[model samples]
Target: MADFSPPDDNKRTGQRGAEKSGRVADFRYRPPSQSKPQKCGTGSSAKKRGGGKTSIPSPKPQGSAPSHHHRKQAYAALDLGTNNCRLLIARPSGENFTVIDAFSRVVKLGEGLAMSGKLSDDAMDRTLGALKVCAEKLRRRNVHLARSVATEACRRAANGPAFIEHVREETGIVLDIISAEEEARLAVLGCHILLEGGEGPAVIFDIGGGSTELILVEPGGKVPRILDWQSVPWGVVSLTDTVGRCTGSRDERLARYADMRRVVSESFAPFAERIAPRAECEEEIRLLGTSGTVTTLASLHLELPHYDRREVDGLIVRSQAMRDISERLSGMSLEERSQLPCIGNDRADLVVAGCAILDSILDIWPSERLGVADRGIREGILRSLMAADAEGERHRREIRGA
Candidate 1:
């Protein structure tokens, strides 16, 4: 299946004034202007300056919408990773959801942390600022329930708890630094809908800015049992920084890509070996990829002059096509890549590193076609929240009836 792209028809309605309590009241705010949030420390100063003056409107609660009498309950999820801080608010409609509003910003929370093993002051400031914005959005939407998580950057940082406290104080958002196991599970959950009909075991890989997560699943099972999982410390941002300093010729660049492939393969070897035997003999062994790399490749394969979520999500790219795209990306200079519609200036430099990581996963799995998923941790968090709420409601009704 192709990557998943939630429709963008969710419109904002309601008032835009501060409540009598001096807090932003219930309002339906629109999605942030950028598709992905800016990474921390990079352009945060400008954003902070501009964000201060930006208008934040409010939205009516679900049941209050006049036209939609049977309005579905709303839920919200937030994911703060090494590189990005994202939030999604949605209203469930049957099995799916209509995203009411979404926000994403690249905070690069893990920036320089790989080398220093600590979250920098500037990075924390940037991330906190973004979180503050998210908190306001949640308040405006009156998000009844939400879950916010921090990933590798926080997990590895020495002052992670202190950082979380700062977030709570500044944004009124609690940040949970999830374990690697939970990270793998959430990744699989995000991709579960796409793997419904796949044969044999399906492998899902997510290459993030600070880490990579791989989850192997046997299809058609109650909660696809995780066959094997692994989290590699290296991600696009770190790998690119390492490679950029090497100073190589064209041949060296290719060689560096090869080296990257080897590094990832080595990290994934044990898990890959366990799954490879089954994958080879099975007809349904397939790869499902989530993250910026695979999506960018899908966009490039479609020859999109610009990044279009509708065109790239759930689109299948053959192994050869993947290679072709990787090679084309490797050959381009940062300036050249920045010009590509799918790879903007912000991602142009890191895209190749992401491609390298992806190539390694593909090489290890050797799947005929890769399934794409745009959803990830945020979706998983939302699903969990909704389910918990339903369970709670059911319990309350049962007690009342009794």
Candidate 2:
């Protein structure tokens, strides 16, 4: 394995905390870049604007393999983040890994962390139960190489270290608390392949439950060089906590959402100065987003009956249309947003916070098209492990030849 650790430090899966606005970086700005979503999608199938790519789909449910294959070894990646615990079990194929099984559950581990620096007992219990499921899956799969990680919530909570100890005792799974820089690197590793074909710089973002990561990359070959990356401490859960749930009338609700956006935009100010000029570079500036926020918006844009990763993954939506949906959702009361088919009570409040964050990104990047990805750290971890497995094989072959 390529030591999943970066030169410094770093660390999602399908299914994916709590910090205030001023912690990550303290800066603010209102740039004039005309940030807007140029296209949006609506239909029975996934949305496809002109120039975008969907991710490689998970193997079919009936997918199977011979047990005697020498080169194929199953690997597992478990991601325990602020809002979700997710597991991915996969085997290396030619260029990609085929998933054998996957598990995801919303644990809301950082639900109130923005207000309280400690992880609440209830949240810890919820996350522990989810981890138990993940641990069982990894053990049964007999994973060859596994890397489990805990993100922002674990990085911020006062009881985070204690919780990590408890998780190992209860589930026998060890989690590494990664740094913000590493978080941005893995996210780019996982999704930069989907960036629109262009010589200009592209922005890839992962809107996590407790924080948001934005990476600016200048496309080289297949991998993107991390030109500059920023991690803002405001995700769906944390943002909602910072800017209270929309509890008043329609106008009041919109006002609250606006307040949330302001907070997020302030955090992006420092980065905005560096990234804003790239919009006019004339190379091919595009934006790729991987997070629950993008996935949900892609679903609403597609008007699907329910959330479908197959359809939503890699879908490109109009920046304007996404903002429109966010605007409408922000105007609705929590009860009304919850009633929507895709977003129920549990996600009702958080979705609006996600919208605020997305809007801020759109304002900063202003890409006509937005790419939505259903994969992140989990896929990145699997990719890295598979690469090492292949490298080891080649090295052994060379030794025999020598």
Candidate 3:
């Protein structure tokens, strides 16, 4: 097994005091690109873009046994969000990890949480079914280290802990309902590599289903420092529920989109003010985004017939282009949206809300080009797990020499 050390040197995930002020601890993280993994080429490998089938990479030929080293080092990350259940299983390969298996399902776990403030029975059932499949994949892949996390839906739900217990009892998966601060940190850790090469200050954001996170970053050397971050309780699901749908005539839809943007702007006002001076001081502000909204919009920007992570991931597009797409989508009727190739029915209802949130983000940061990333928390988790294993191995070697 890889002997990576646990990331104890990293800052605490708790948010209070200084953290509450939008400032976080100076955490150190060496990205996989900066450091080589202990073992290379051990294993071989989306979005819960709903209204689609789960994607599983083709496996090795039947009856072919994976190498023992691959089995011992395989790691998995499960991200159970308000709208989706996604899993990634991989092993360290050179500077990065090679994904062996993956699964994604749109469970809509927080479907009615805005009104009910609880995980609905139906939502739970849907999510559990997804998790069952993930469990099977994990077992089949022989995952040696795994981390499962539940986001905003669980954090805000009154019955979240109980549901977590139920999931554990049913599937043997323990979920860590992380803090908003931790969520922001993990996202930055995962996708910062995609930011267009620049040393000037930058902002990276994730527009999630139940919440949106915006992080102001100070970049210099290998690891960027977190200047500030904020998590607003307005994601595609929550925001759509609050703002209502973009229904009726074109004028009405435009009004609804404007309203959504205003709401998000107000929520982001304080953070925007805090970072205003910093943005002004910097020569350039690079922007990167990791979420369904960015990835879907990127696909649209590319005019792909279907969603392709290979083409979308790490792609950069003009900020004006994204805003244009957002406005166009906001004007389209629900049925019109459902017919789009990358959107389909599952994401049609929520994509407008996402657009509104993104538009608001643009108002604040106003970067020229927006870098899109299909990777986020799960990739961050995999890197952390593998890095820890590598660190552990180095320590053991030191002990042997001593």
Candidate 4:
């Protein structure tokens, strides 16, 4: 009932990579240092440079081993979102980092947050237990530098800070409550490589448990520069909590699904309006989504017996197919949806909300295809950490030469 599953043990084969132009190749993670990166802050905010562009230096990807001096340095990134707790541990490879350990669990940390405006005790307990496991992994892996972040749920909860301090006291892991802007930037940094190659600006989104982030980026550098972004307080968990799951007649469920769409659309109105004028003129609109919602839907689109990141991540599905699947999932009853593979009892109830959110996204930015990315904030953090370390190493070399 806790919704906790064992760690993945790197079974996913995190074959993520990036190109010099910030596009995907054989699933890699290209470090931001490969390009001239402007100085930017980390932990709580995104790095914004001149020309109204937000820079999220791509983190180092996982690849070949580094020199002997760099072999011992292991970095970790933990993303504790509203619905899940995920951790990634890796070491800097030649130009990227190789994943050594990873863990993901559906803890639903924001289970009752919408109604209570606070993190419920049960949810906190569940998350803490999962974090304990993450702490153990970090210890066993001997992670040299680690950054753990708590997103929307923690940011919205009144007792979020208290819970964060408690987590440090209990697990010795410091969790930074990052801004929605930073969250959006990090999500893009993690998965932008998967975006379909194109000329015009693209939209990358992360549908979290408590909040959904949509970012518009102009891609031409090592990392795409954010043109505009918005974080709506309507993710799978929050939206589901606000809109009852209409478990009655099929018509009733469809109506509620419409209601969910309406709410999300209105919330996204400002963002939609801002991008419409610019996006409408572009020859082709490129859209990429990184979150459980997109991944789950991608899995269903593939008709796989179970979830597989290798296939889902960096995959593209027809926008119309995604829309049709979202509508279908929205109409299904909780039990009916639960029976479907890739969306069992765990995601049955909340998947509908996700569908609604995705529907709204497709409506605003109508694209021929939607790119799916299983990697996000955690991978972004890993890249940033490795880039910083590489920079520090360069500084040491310069001092030694001087």
Give the alpha carbon lDDT tens digit for every residue of 1-402 in model 4: 122111111111111121223221111221123344321210111111111112223454333333477755888899999999999888766555678889999999989888877888778888888998998898888778888888988888878898887777666788888877778767887888888888966889999998888888888877887777877888898888887775899988998888888888877888888889767974788899999999899889888899987778778878899898998988888899999999998999999999999999998999888888888888888787777666666676668879
RMSD of 1: 12.9
User: Clashing pairs in model 2?
Assistant: 10-182, 12-377, 12-378, 16-84, 17-209, 17-210, 37-319, 37-320, 39-318, 40-318
What local lDDT does model 1 show for residue 322? 85
CA lDDT of each prediction against the hidden true structure: 0.67, 0.73, 0.76, 0.77
Error of 1 at 296 (Å): 0.9
How far off is residue 167 in model 3, in Å?
Answer: 0.6
lDDT string for model 3 (104-131, tens) is: 9988988888877777878888888898
Cα lDDT of candidate 4 equals 0.77
Candidate 1 has its poorest 10 consecutive residues by lDDT at 45-54
Q: Which of the two, 3 or 4, has more TM-score? A: 4
Which tens-of-lDDT digit does each residue in 322-372 have in candidate 2? 999999899998888888877887789899989999999989898888888
**How far in Å is the alpha carbon of 130 misplaced in model 2?**
0.6
Off by over 4 Å in 2: 1-70, 396-402
Give Cα distance to truth, residue 163, candidate 3, Å.
Answer: 0.5
Q: Which stretches of candidate 3 lie over 4 Å from their true place?
A: 1-72
Superior candidate under lDDT, 1 versus 4: 4
Model 2's alpha-carbon lDDT is 0.73
